[model samples]
Each structure stands twice: as C-alpha cells, then as structure tokens.
Target: MRTNQSSQEEVEKTLQSITGIERASPNPFFLTRVEARLAARRSAPGVTTPWAFRPVWVAASLGLALMLNVSAVMYAREALTQDDQEQETVSLSAEWGFDATVMDW
Candidate 1:
C-alpha cells in the first residue's frame, strides 16, 4: 500500500515536470531566396564540362576497356595454343626384345 502511494506521487511529479510549447516561428523570405538561387544557377551555362555532364561517356569507357581486355585474353590464348602445336613430337613402335621401329607417317 505504501509503495503504491509513493509510485503514484513520483508519477504525478514526473508528469508535472514535462512542458509543451504550442507556438513556433517561421523562416522569413526562405522561399524567395531559394527561388533566386535556383534562377541564378539555371542562368549560368559555362559551369560544367560537356562529357562530365553526361552518363553515357562513363558507360562507353567501361565498354571499351572490357572489349580491349577480352581481345588481349583471346590473343594470348591463341598464341599459347599455336606455340604448343608448333612443338612437334615423334612416336616409335617396339618389336620383340630391344629393337624399335621409328614410324613417321
């Protein structure tokens, strides 16, 4: 009984300590300044590079690099295969004991 009464008193004290403000002030001329800045930025023309203003240049550059890498890999693989084929090998047939016949056909 005593604990419940003490808790209720504490809750009432906490509720009384909270404050709520109903009125707020607004920023004057905020919209006007935002519109003026937007207009000024739009009127400026020489602020950026031609390629930097587009997304296609980056994609094209990536595509070109990918093609070059693919081409280099293909060429390297072809050269390796050609070199491996160029190293010719020979085979021989065994007769009975220690005689072998070299067959080049």
Candidate 2:
C-alpha cells in the first residue's frame, strides 16, 4: 500500500513536469529540398555489371550445381551400400567359421 502511494505521487510529478511543452516548427523549404534530392536520385542512371547478373546465367549455374550435388549424393550412397555389403559378408563368414578370402561371389 505504501509503495502504491509513492508510485501514484511519482506519476503525478511526471505529469506536472511536461506542463510547459511547446510544439515543434519545421523550416519553410525543408520539404522542397527533400523533394528535389529525391527527384535527382530518381533521374540518375544506375550502373550494372555485364556478365554475372543475367537471369538465364544465374538459373543455368544453379541448375548445374544442383545436378552435380545430386550426382555426388548418389555416388556416396552407392559407395556406402557397397561398404555395408562387404561388412555383412565378412560378418557372415566369421559367424560360419569360413575364410572371408575364399568366399565365392
């Protein structure tokens, strides 16, 4: 209850502190100057590089990268499968008390 009263007093003080506030005034030509600068920027010609920014080239490069990524993933999967098969064959040979080197394909 005491804290609430103190907070209310602080709020009253804060409200009284801004009693003499005044509105801001703008310069007369500020808007026209800003508009002129905007117009100049809009009318200026922009620079562009020749080779690397074309849509066709970008798409073609992206497609090539995707294809290479897919091929690499497939190759990795095939190699992993081959390794698993070889491991499985070794484990089977060991379990059956057979020589792994003599297993016929």
lDDT of 1 by residue, 12-60 (tens): 9888776554566668988889999999899997777798447888888
Instruction: Give the clashing residue pairs of candidate 1, or none.
Output: none
How large an RMSD does model 1 have? 8.4
Provide the lDDT at 37 for model 2: 91
In model 1, where do residues sit more than 4 Å from their true spots?
1-39, 42-53, 89-105
* Window of ten residues with lowest summed lDDT in model 1: 88-97
Quote the positional error of residue 6 for candidate 1 in Å.
Answer: 95
lDDT of each: 0.75, 0.91
Q: Pick the candidate with the highest TM-score.
A: 2
RMSD of each: 8.4, 10.6
Candidate 2: where are CA atoms >4 Å away? 1-49
